[model samples]
Target: MAIRLDFQTEKKQGSLLITEESESNKTDVIRGFFSLFGFEKEPMQTTVYSPEIVVHSQGKAEEIQKQVSEAINQRLQQLESRPSKDEVEIKKPELINSKRTLNPTIGEMIGGAPQQEAPPEEPEWYQTGIKNKEGVPHYKLRYWCKNPQCRDRSNDYIKEDQKTVKCRKCGQKLLVRQAADEHMKRDEWGNFFIADKLAP
Candidate 1:
């Protein structure tokens, strides 16, 4: 008996040819191979086939041939059940909009363009006209939240003795500095002028 395996793919196609010398010889070889691979309980008694066994053999070779044919047919059915290259549909990948932002917006869901947000205002100093015992002027700082995710921006009234201040909403540290009134010349109302400097 002869067996042939034909396989085809999208890029390549091939055929495999398998032949047996004789029915009895092929049966012995198949039994030996299966036993060698632990597929059978009995091991091959002799590596070489004897004339006596061949002459004495009645219907054993035919039985083994039938089993081998059934196994090959079952395997071919399994291969045929799989999706073939020609039967399978190839889909093109979806095009991603790189310009689109990761943050989902109401406008995006409604099929409208999203509105751009105004840039945050930078921190600025404001004098409160309050002075400590040492005559150092106190100032309030209006700053934006340092946290990228936080939008809470407000003024924090820092005490004269307080060295550090943080955002009340996000707990992010605020950069604060005392007004150097002693080092600057002030007008009659006691407001320090940035352009005027005191004598060394």
Candidate 2:
């Protein structure tokens, strides 16, 4: 007669080992044997069910057992040497800013220095008193560029039809001063204020 033997293996200390094996005379043995023994084993690894191995004598059974054991042990050793999912370490890629530079070249260092701009000049307004044809009092506001570096610094008058005015030569914005009356006196800063009345 012939016999079949089924075995299950387990992993321990990062290695696979056959901890349990059972024999069946003719039929397949259910893997529930390990559960009855109070613990569950790993999945079934190797099964030895060769029809050539006959048990006519006890010596033949011993030989069959030796051959099956060697086959199962060799397969287990192969599985053990391989790395498991938990044993592998997954490395993530590092992030970096595209515009940032670690080192500056000679050309970049020379051009990178920030240039300072010249401070703006204060505006000056010139007012001229005049009267309308109906004798209703009015005044004309005038201004010109005073920037020493501009060609328009000596330009006495700039005529414009629009209310908002800028220097024609230098393009700098000009301020305007309006007097409430001809008697309104102007300070050095172009601001108008009523002066105290003087005795005749």
What lDDT score goes with residue 152 in model 2?
Answer: 60
Over 77-171, each residue of candidate 1 has an lDDT whose tens digit, in order, gives: 77789998999999988687646668877876788796778987653432334444355555444455556677566654445455455666767
Q: Across residues 108-199, which tens digit of lDDT does each residue of candidate 2 receive?
A: 68897466788766433333433243554433334545555663632222222323345567666555433244534444544332112121
Each prediction's TM-score versus the true structure: 0.27, 0.21
- In candidate 1, what residue range of length 10 has the lowest lDDT sum? 48-57
Off by over 4 Å in 1: 1-20, 27-61, 77-114, 120-182, 185-200
Clashing pairs in 2: none
Question: Model 2 misses residue 12 by how many Å?
Answer: 42
Superposed Cα deviation of residue 1, candidate 1 (Å):
8.9
RMSD (Cα, Å) for all candidates, in order, is 16.3, 17.2
